[model samples]
Target: MNSSALVKHISECFIKPQYEVEEANKPVYLAPMDLVMLSVHYIQKGLLFTKPPSNSDDQISFSTPEFLESLKESLSHTLVYFYPLAGQLATQVDEARQESLVFVDCNKGPGARLVHATIDMTVSDILTPRHVPAVVQSFFDHDRAVNHDGHHMSLLTIQVTELLDGVFIGCSMNHALGDGTSYWNFWNVWSEIHMAKNRTDLVIPSSHLPIHNRWFPDGHDAPILLPFTRHDQFVSRYEAPPLAERIFHFSPESMSRLKSKANKDHQKIYTDSKRMISSFQALSALCWRSIIRAIRLPDDQVTNCRLAANNRHRLDPPLPENYFGNCINAITTTTTVSELHEHSLGWAASMLHQSVANHTNKALQDFLKRWLKSPFVYQIHQLFDSNSVMMGSSPRFDMYGNEFGLGKPVAVRSGYAHKFTGKVTSYQGYEGGGSVDLEICLPPHAMEALESDEEFMGAVSLPLTGY
Candidate 1:
């Protein structure tokens, strides 16, 4: 759609009545996962042939304020639809507590290149697969880009691109918007409803998980469950240029071999939940170590890496699927740069596994619940350690199957990272079954090191069994 039409469409969307919460007086609580908004950042780009578009008049374009208001309208709908969820989470997040508002900024300088719209990133990098071909190329170049920080406030931005045609659309959703699965479901449904002009029949189906928070007295006060503050320590303002993305495909056969080689009894394990994180853990450790070594940082410099974990399953009562916001935390494991240089894949994988296992215990969960309710949260934000690299698996994004009846996503990608949080990586199920695709953003040197590492290359050859 052209910028003008998109603006009108947005204004019309906002004309609809806002939804009211059943209980307006309840305290707005923040979910553990909501903290991502504070750390989330965005970078987008558009690619074109040398000739560019001959149809100059038909190219995507947007005036700054028009684009911002357009985003404001869409977000308003999102806020109203998920009001209760936001209201509850708001009690915890600073931005959400202020009201369900989305923030917008205009990017007019070279520094603005840090974050790009989702559509621009995907289209410019990954090839659009036929199965998920609904590439909304026009949207990214024309619509406003929104970034949500930890405070749960959306920072909306608009970039005037030189693109003569096509489109780019992207948004950095707070982790609180549910996992990639939940977000896509909500997005698909929202788009359907919006496009249909009020057709409720197109709404997405929900499995309906339980919707209340549980305070497990039994799970509190565990020594290993220490709270680390991410707020003050991790600032989420500046944008960085899009780090080059390297996609690696894994085959099932290689994965089986790796698992067999690592297993004690020579038994084969073939489950997605158990092995996904473990495999990635091994790979990530290897990757992290290799990068550190290549950089030639002092051996004494610690290289701590973390895996983000969703506490929904670990909780006594699982959070509702539609909670619509961040609801997870991380499992941090530290290693001396020297230690990783000498360890084998099995050893690193074990470290990663144990770190996660340690957190899954009752003590961690209990401590987390109590910690959230206590005043310690203020103190924790003061401790942002610089030695860590954070990576998470987003294998839950079923891009190809997220068919909106217009074909599936031609390409799927998670957004960018802020300056403070360190490196971030997200893995997704590729077009081929058993094949996986990975998106990574790290310091430029780290990317170069991975490209030259032989061991990392071996791991990349591993098989993709299934999602």
Candidate 2:
């Protein structure tokens, strides 16, 4: 095996939809809410599968020629349901108003991208380390490009990397195209299609079809115009400081205990079962407190933890659970370090719970309406500060169920897309059943400080190893 080169690219090809896209669906209007994320990095995510048995008389492994063909063909069929993925971003610049508009041009014959690559390392080489190695990022090539760059590049890119002993299927999805739920939905359908092997008679059922209609505020229309004419005005690009990314595994018991402690002290506050503290809120609060303590932010200064809230269910008459595209709203909670020191764990967790619970349907509408009036793209620095924690991703996503001929995934990992100092992502642990893998990025000193904190480290399990 060549150690000098970690990842070797084998081939690259564009996969178009299996059938012709309807002319009516050729263009997808960019909603005001979707444009806010146009400049953010594409979501870099992938999974690791167990070692494949050598070529045998009967078994067809994931890397087998027959299986690879099925996988590619399955993707083509999956694209018909998710037609916007097989397109490029289009910009409408208005010189008169100094505003630029972004939308999806889905008619381009060249659809989504698929890359075939190989790595010299084994599964052990990746999962053995306490902190995941940086080479894991090599499985993806478009991490550095923002979603706005999708105008020329494919809106969705998939890279399949064959390891010395295992395989990794990495996906780089444009943030504007979909959120985590939509992303996993596409993969799940693709895997379903691949289960038939070479069969072409299967088709996505109408019930499973994704709703592409962009959500809009009342009295507002699509193609939400941006205030700036150029990408440079809003897209944030700067040299980030050195950082360490680590994943902390938490068992169901630990998560439950955290939730219990948080809810114990908040009974008098909530008094309602519907407003009970959740494992997510408790765990997130724990991370936020530990990071602030590790970084030693001034007690007098204010701090914040911004959470990604899915609004599909929060709307009046609630959008369909399968509603595709970005319907994510953020909940930012501010507090002082001294207040955190004086409060119990439950108190901090309650702040998070309340922040989310308080975001009513009217609030969701108001937030979007305000953004529609004064549109601005999300900037990197806003969430990149070491003093704050920006938590995205969710433990509810079926990360372990993405099967494509191979067995269940051994672990789930993300690439270097949104790896800022305080960025955090939570994945459903491979063991399943309420287990969670908490991935966080921080400076080296702060990471070390966190690992040493007895109160925080006590609830976390050891690093992941191939089972």
- TM for every model, in the order presented, reads 0.61, 0.94
User: Per-residue CA lDDT of candidate 1, range 1-467, in tens?
Assistant: 22222211221111221444443334333343333343343332221211122347777433434444443444445444444323212212234333222211111111111122222232332343211122332333212222333233332222222223222334334343344444554555444444444543434355422233322234332111113323344343444443444445555554554544444221233222344335555555655665565556677888777776766566566555545444566677888878877766666666777787777647456655665565232111233343566666455544445332223344444333332234555545444544555555445566677667786567566323211
Q: Against the correct fold, how does model 1 do in TM-score?
A: 0.61
Give the C-alpha lDDT of model 1: 0.43
| Model 2: CA > 4 A from native | 1-5, 23-25, 55-64, 197-199, 203-207, 268-274, 463-466
Top TM-score prediction, candidate number: 2
Candidate 2, lDDT over the whole model: 0.82
Alpha-carbon runs more than 4 Å astray in model 1 = 1-27, 31-81, 84-167, 175-185, 188-198, 202-204, 208-245, 251-258, 264-277, 369-387, 419-422, 461-467
TM-score of 2: 0.94
